[model samples]
Target: MGIEREIKLALPPEQADAADRFFSGIAGTPGRDVPLVNIYFDTPALALAGQKVALRLRKTPDGWLQTLKAAGSVQGGLHSRHEWETSVPGEALDFVALEHACDDAAALAALRAAASELGERFRTAFVRRLWQFEFDGARIEAAIDRGEVTAQVSGQTRREAISEIELELLRGEEPALHALTVRLSAAVAGLTPEDINKAQRGYRLCAQ
Candidate 1:
C-alpha cells in the first residue's frame, strides 16, 4: 500500500496569500512547492495511538489544490522485497493533494478517516528517494508519462547492474495495465531488469 495521501484546503482570504507565499518555492520550481502538509487523523480518542494512517485532501487559494500524506514507521509483515516478515505495517499521517488535481474543485476541505487505529505494525517498509543512473546498451527500460510515479527500482545482479522502471497507477486509473504493459514492454525492448539487480535509491542489496 502507498503511504502518501493528498488533501485540499480552503484557507481564509488572508491566509490564502500567505499559504501561496509559503509554498511559492516548495518542490521543484517557484510557486510549485511540494510541502508535506501536517494534518493528522487521530485514532483511539483516549490514546494518540499513532499518526493517522491516511492523508487529508483539501482545496487551497487561487483555486489551487494541496495534499498531506501520512508518515511513520511501518514494521513487520512481508516486505515486497521479501515474503517472510511478521505482521504490522502501516503509514504514519499526512495529506497530499497533488494526487487528485483536476477533480471537482468547488468543494472545500472534505475529509475521510480510516476505519482502523493509527501506529505502524510492520517490520519493513518502503520510502521515497531519488537516484541517477546511466543506462548502457547492456539493458533497457521504459516510462509511461501518466500521473503515476516514475520511481525506478535498481540493483546489481551477477556482473552488471539491472534497473526496472516502475510506476504506481490507481486500481483503475485509465489505460489498463495489459494495454499499457504492451507499450511499456515495447519501449523497454531488450531491458531485462539487469541494470539494478540489487540497488535502489542509494542503497545496495545482496553480496555486492
Candidate 2:
C-alpha cells in the first residue's frame, strides 16, 4: 500500500497558457504528453463507494493498471489517500491481488465478495502533461490535465470538462507540497482549491 499526498487546483481555461509559462522555469525538463483513459468500477449499489474507496482501471502509454484507493480526507484541495496499484493485462480487475494488499480486513472481504459484480460506473479521458521538479528539498510531480469526464446512463451520455493542476509529492515533506501550491497560485490567476476528484465528478455526471 502507498500513501498519496497531493493538491488539486481548478484552473480557468484561458489561464492555461499563463500557467504553462509560470512553471517553465521551475520545471527543468518537461515529459512527453500522455493521453489517458480511466474507467471507474463499482457494484450497482456502490458498495465500494460506501466504504469510501474506489477502483479504477487506467489505460496509459505504459499499459493498463488497476488501482484501488482507500477513503481519505480531502480539505481545501489537499488530498491524502492510500492507494495500491499493479499492472494488468487488460481492463479486467485482479481482485485477488487487490484484496490481498488491502489492509482493512472487513473492507477486503466485502470487496472480494463484490468483485465479481463490479462494473464500469464512469470514465475520464484526458491529455496530461507532466513535469518534475526539486523544490525546497522536495521532489514533486506537477501534472496539467485537460480532458472530459463522460458518463453513460440510461442510454444517454453526459460530459464535464476537466482542467486542473495536480501537484503530487513524489518524495518530500508535506509542507513543501503546500508551499509549492501556494507559490503557483500566486503566479497564476483564478486558481482555486478543488475538493472533488475525477471519479467523484464522473459519478455525479452519471447520476444526473
Candidate 3:
C-alpha cells in the first residue's frame, strides 16, 4: 500500500478556465486531459464505512483500477491516507489483492467479509487536466477536474457539480505542497481550502 498525501480544493465552476490557463505555463511535463468515471461501493449496512474503509472502481484511459483506501487524518487542506490500487480488466473487486493490501489482520478479516456484500452506491465522472512539476524541491502532480457526481435513487439520477484543484506530492516534503497552494491561492481568486473528498461528497449526495 502507498500513502497518499495531497490537498483538495473546491473551485468555482466559472474559475476553472482561468486556473487552467495559469497552470499551463508552469514548469512541468504537461499531462493528457482525460475522463474518469469512478464508482464507489459499500455494503447495505455501510460495513466498510463503519470501519473507515472505502472501495472504488475507476475507469480511466488506461483501464479500470480498483482502489481500497483507509480513512486518514485531514488537517486544513492536507490529507494523509493509505491507499492500495491495481489494474483490473473489469469493475469487480479482487479480494485476494485487496486482502493483501490490508495492513493488519483485523482489517483484512473485515474486508474479506464485506467484499461479498459490496454494491455501487454512487459515482463521479470528470475530465481531468494534469501536469507534473518540480516546485521548491518537491515533485507535485497538479490536476484540475471539472465534472459532476451522480447518485441513483429509485431509478432516477441526482447530479452535483464538481470543480476542484488537486496537488499531490509525488516526491519530497509536504510543506512544499502547502507552500505552492499558498502561492496559487494568492494568484487565483475564489480558491479556498477544501477538506472534503470526492467520496464524502458522493456519499452526502446519495444520502440526500
The lDDT leader among the candidates is: 2
**Model 3 agreement with the true structure over 1-208: per-residue lDDT tens digits:** 6899999888988887777766776753455699999999998777887888888999998889988888798988788998888888887878877776667665576678887888998899999999888889999889998898998877889888889999999999988998999888877889888898888888887778
| TM-score head-to-head 1 vs 2, winner | 2
On TM-score, the candidate that comes out on top is 2
Query: How do these models rank on TM-score, best leading?
Result: 2, 3, 1
Q: Candidate 2, residues 10-125: lDDT per residue as tens digits?
A: 99989988778767769855455899999999888888887887889999999999888888889999999988888889878888777767787656766776788899989999
In candidate 3 the C-alpha lDDT for residue 157 amounts to 92
C-alpha displacement of 77 in model 2, angstroms? 0.6
- Can you tell me which runs of candidate 2 are displaced by over 4 Å? none
List candidate 3 stretches off by more than 4 Å. 28-31
Candidate 1's C-alpha runs over 4 A off are 1-164, 171-175, 193-207
Any idea what lDDT model 3 has? Answer: 0.85
TM-score to native of every candidate shown: 0.21, 0.96, 0.94
